[model samples]
Target: MLSRVAPWLASRNENGLGVRVLGGADTLALRALANEDAVANVFILAHLESTGTAAPTSGGASVFGVFDGDTLLGACWAGANLVPVQLEPGLAGYVANAAHQTGRRYASIFGPAETVLALYSRFEQLGHLAHEVRADQPLLSISGGPAIGANPDLSFGSMADFDRILPACAAMFEEEVGYSPFLGGQEFYSKRVAGLIRQGHSLVHIDAQGTVIFKAELGAVTRDVTQVQGVWMNPELRGRGQSAGYMAAVVNLSRTFAPVTSLYVNDYNTKARATYERVGFEQVGTFATVLF
Candidate 1:
């Protein structure tokens, strides 16, 4: 069986549509295909742009590719967060066999549903466990939409707002992922918050006491797409019916940075989905996530 399965072996370049870990020499090929589906590939592209195929010393992350005789066909990035980013399909078996040896066990696997599912199924067939599978997330996008509404209090977050925004960010992460992001350690997460604030990527609405009531971050921006993430509202404020208006405000603010604003949400998130619809986002594709 080992001999028969050798064609898809990873970490080395081989003949035909084989699997191998990518390196600096593969940068141009990887970047071309990653940009071909920029929104879906942003996580990997963001890494590739910074490190350019050089494996980082501390990030505990690596990118792998499936090549058709050295021509790239697909790639996947496994990183410190454990959310393996699926960039293309047609290499499920390759990813399945390569996951553990290429990187540590992950928290989740996410991407376009069809590809994510294909990879997850193959991965699990080899005995990995999935704590949850969000198999039908709607990938939404907006461009040239109707004018967005405004909220007097909703505005971009700054260094001044960092302390106030961090708790809300932690709350949102816990609620969405079933655990506090602070579990690992405060320093890494804290640095992430500060970095986003410094870059003007965070937005929030604060009250008189400087409590953050609404928060979101511009998570990724590339020439082809921009993504919004970490959206949250103070739980006590819910059912007062303010989310729709504030979300629209974000949509308007978002377009200034990129012509297209995109995000993916679990299919069961009816309220969030409705708010996005009201804000002019349309479901352009489906995504899936497997949480471990």
Candidate 2:
């Protein structure tokens, strides 16, 4: 049986390691655990806290844990996306045993620095490929850019717009999230879009042709920060640099509600990454997503 660790953030030693789900009130503590510079849990905790969804299955969900036998080590929860664990040195055996016990197959994994190589080698021994390298680059804005201007027909979308927006929204989800919202359903997708609209964070750009050609939505928002998400341009217009301008415009527009803006991109996506850099986003850190 796995040892149960208390969920209190303040109770952690930064030296004791185990995995347990902290209840709702304990989220702040989880946030504290993430703030530790040495082992900041990024996507795992952010999604857990933001979306309040956590399920551990071979092909879904994400889970995180702290390893405290010596130094406090925080690892990202890739769930069943990759085998065993995303970050490791301590407890690879434990992760493997757990996955085995549950009959799950972890196809591959990713992590930061040498830690990734070590885990990769172990998974290779377990018969999975260390075949690819992936990086989740975190981006934050630094210095100059106008907050708001050139308001190009900005307006909040109503539910009435869903019929028209569904196709593009679903496409954005597939491209950015790596999954289709249909599998998750329309309600979840609609709620997500509505939330952004309510916050005045979803924007669309239409050309003189009256075609809705560009769109971007907020994934996360706070008093000081708004994350650009679901960014897309109609496929027919892919060759043009329309996305970059819309991104800048979104940043400019969102600043009215939030002061700092940030987002993440897959490292292999050099095109989108370059566009973000051109519009003034600086790489602040890295993150990863493990797909089973």
Candidate 3:
């Protein structure tokens, strides 16, 4: 594990700018930096609040920081996916270079549009190409009650609905990522869905025949915001006018955990975008994703 992070530890530029693995002592500074844009940095903030700044002993994930002297300027969550937080566009190349030196293969890189794309550009220069680049995802959020009526049928999922919900989740993942999430094994993905259900993070509207009508998960959450993901409506039900109500219900239900509800949608998803707008969400920023 030390060897995995050694390159970052030893790298420092002439201008006092450097990238290194963050430790527990850096928690306060890191949290402060993430708070600069709570909605955009909610994922890292949630992780920090839950897990602190210590890197995992298994070498699975670690927070890397960019600093000038002792001041924290930006950071990146180097794990299954690289998530940049408050990373300045000009400094992205440094972070990407350090990440490349670690020889870690990330599944994706995602976050604010400018930072993600800048980081991806540096990665591309390092010969780390992406399978796809979604460069214009709108990051939408809502802080008050939704504009439409809530769906009466939508409810938080439970273990009893797991059988139906898991397939819908997998379908959404496959549709979005261009591969089945179950390709490696079902256990990991199954546990993830089950955990979200158990934690009351999974929301769904299952029909009488046990078919999922609509589903979405609060993938990243904090007291201030909940980032929605894996949102899906049954293919058979897509053309109906029910999406707005269902999404309104999602916003209403999600507020129980956090005041602000947020989710990013691909620029090409006009229907979802329209439904979200109808439900009262407004674009706060742009996000980008580089799928590996």
Candidate 4:
């Protein structure tokens, strides 16, 4: 848990209306704020539920909160990526300012479209330029069974499939992010994949030859929602009209962890968007990502 005595990053009036590192005492307030939009805030909420606000994660990640006097209003998870929770566009500047003061370089800033763009604008003014900005990613969710038939072969991944799953995950990451996740070192990325598999979060379909056919992970999970991510299909199978069935399976499997299954996708990816629609997902909100 974060220390209550942790120095304030940005203090305002005596009533404490400013951005600062959240401590264990602020857990309830933070949860209340994040739960306001559970589906959209699942990533941060999952982290909080699993790790608490006691101390930073092994990756030096911490939750930063914005307050209006003593009442908590918004939060951002400062980690590999910046995930804003219930943050208004107007308040993003304050969070961005506080984040910038830490002198940390983030892989990306992502969340509700307005807030993310607002935060990115602040960072831009501070001389931080992005390699790419996905300004309009649709956040889609499904609460009921998928419309398409689920692929029976798709199932939770295990260590026995780790070798195949790891490389496939890396390929998806590189193709999406424009850089290899293994650029820094493969150890960290490998551990993340293994960890997800160990938690039963990795979902995959591997062929007899040990090739990953379809893969996706329940990246963020809470009792109410689970966000699907790292969705991928074998290149040889593209345009074979197979994504819907696989995605239907993802939706079905995801329900074992949470009632709602959710994922966000780039606006330009019309094919993937259509596949999700075919699987019964409905657009719930918009998200944006500014890759650094």
Candidate 5:
């Protein structure tokens, strides 16, 4: 593994560049930037927060960076059992070599559309398949306007509600998000959900009937920017003009935490795009998700 990375590592040195695990005082600054940049990026940054907390099982996760003297040029981090974040412009060759050196099969990645295409091409040449593409875009706006409709009873979900809501949560994730960790069993799923909630990074909306309709996994509360993620609405309640209301309420509530807030929508999800637009979110940039 070291042998495979040697030449590339040497090349970086020749350019007065070095790559290693992130460290020191700037860790907080880097983490803040990643949170502002993107929520997924923030989640990756969370891994760097090993302050008395158990390091998340790398499972298939790792972070690397490219630096020139005191300047950080780029960095990448893959989540446990998920695709890695590819933040650099042209380091696909080095990435692939490193992956092979580590004896991994393939790496999942997501970022700007063009970057994904480039990495996909590079990975394909190395016999890896970048078979699935999830087209999504970061939607952002300064939140302070009146909501479009009546506010539903909304609150953060409690841990005790997990048993009743877990199945629905799993189904919504599998259907809309196209992934389900619970397929392994309730244990893995429970722990993952608990970890997210314990981080105080998720929001839930329940109707008067006490049903979970809309939920979003949010990132850390930092700066004036709050990030919305893993948004889900009950499938049976789609097209009732409710999504707009839910989004508006979430945004309105988020303002108490941060001045700026953002979320991502699948490019192919016109309905969601329209709903979000109705609530005042503007398209920032496109992101590509490569499923391995």
Candidate 6:
């Protein structure tokens, strides 16, 4: 089990942590809090920067939190993504109830493992199944650049290669997410993949026949860090000593966008973790994902 929840931000006065919706004026404090652990907070910070408000009233979602006087102890984003960051058990329970009360739909709940588990337990008790729960996934981050030789085969994918790469992308999504991105509809997810391709975020390694051998993407980006996700290798290519070096190539490629590259892997996945370690990723934290 993770350590007991800390009192860093949740209790600073006789009043204790006060829970409420964060407003636009809280933006500066939010950024400062996010900067404490840039890699872990990148998604929230990026969303905040994009929307200019902690709680965007225009359509996405809102940020609710537990604050100690004026210091933010932890916060939860109840938006399209449904993320919680650095939340302790008490704060997490509060946020979980808040999410239920608001009745907003979200895709996933992922962040620090303990907080995620805490929040998910509350949500589950409230009748949400959280169909798939990935607990104890190691969150890894690499600063600077790749420490090993890059795979000569890798390249940034492009719009022109969309049709060629779409199948590979779909395969990776299903394999990792346990469901096809096209489950609800193809157009939205297709456009999302295409948008990443247009931004030169998709990295691919192809064979002589032009079939994708391995592929991944810079899935999320912030000023100081970018997260690499959707990593997949051809089944035929597995256990061939090729993955680590290929991941090195991906990390080096990702450096063009941000100095740090981050990703999380299942704790049970020894092979993938080994590949990432061999390629220079260090476990900085742990993440959990409650997939509904």
What ranges in model 2 sit over 4 Å off? 1-16, 36-63, 67-133, 136-151, 154-156, 175-180, 183-201, 206-210
* lDDT: the better of candidates 1 and 3: 3
Those runs of model 1 whose alpha carbons end farther than 4 Å from true positions after fitting are 1-15, 50-58, 81-89, 145-147
For model 5 the TM-score comes to 0.78
Clashing pairs in 2: 15-68, 16-68, 17-68, 63-77, 81-292, 83-106
Task: Give Cα distance to truth, residue 188, candidate 5, Å.
Answer: 2.3
Tens-digit lDDT string for candidate 1 (1-292): 1112223334443445576777777777777887777777766666666566634436556676766785777777766433334444446667666776654777788788766777776666667778888889999888854345766577888888778888889889899989888996899899999998887779899999888889999888665567889989898899787887887777777767767788899889999998888778898888888888
Q: Which stretches of candidate 4 lie over 4 Å from their true place?
A: 1-16
Query: Which portions of model 5 miss their true places by more than 4 Å?
Result: 1-14, 24-41, 44-61, 81-86, 105-107, 135-141, 145-147, 177-179, 207-210, 219-221
Cα TM-score per model: 0.87, 0.63, 0.94, 0.93, 0.78, 0.90
Higher-TM-score candidate of 4 and 6:
4
| lDDT assessment of candidate 5 | 0.60
Model 5 residue 282 distance off true place after TM-score fit, in angstroms: 1.0
Tens-place lDDT digits, model 6, residues 1-292: 3234433233433466577888988887777777788888888877766677676667657888778777888887777666886667666767877788878766789988888877777777778787788988999999987778989889999887888788899998888888898987899889988988987889998778888899998888876898988899998889899998889999888888888999999999999999999989999999998898
Across 1-292, the per-residue lDDT of candidate 2 in tens digits comes to: 0112212333443445565423444444445554453122333444555565444434354454445653334444545353222344444433433334445566445444334434444444555543345535554553346332334554444555555556778888787656687784578667767766665667776556656687777665554556666777899989787567767777777777567666767777888887788788887656543333
Clashing pairs in model 1, backbone N/Cα/C closer than 3 A: none
Q: Rate the local accuracy (lDDT) of all candidates.
A: 0.74, 0.55, 0.89, 0.89, 0.60, 0.82
RMSD (CA, angstroms), candidate 2: 7.7
Task: List the candidate 3 regions with Cα displacement exceeding 4 Å.
Answer: 1-12, 57-59
In candidate 4, which residue pairs get closer than 3 Å at backbone N, Cα or C atoms, i.e. clash? 1-53, 1-54, 1-55, 2-53, 2-54
Per-residue C-alpha lDDT of model 3 across residues 262-292, encoded as one tens digit per residue: 9999999999999999999999999999999
Q: What TM-score does structure 3 among the candidates reach?
A: 0.94
Instruction: Name the weakest run of 10 consecutive residues (lDDT summed) in model 4.
Output: 1-10
- Kindly list the per-residue Cα lDDT of model 5 for residues 68-150, writing each as its tens digit: 78765555553432333545545544555455556665436666654555556666666777557664555455456534763
Question: Candidate 4 on 203-234: residue-level lDDT in tens?
Answer: 99998988889999999999899999999999
lDDT of 3 at 105: 96
Candidates ranked, most accurate by lDDT first: 3, 4, 6, 1, 5, 2
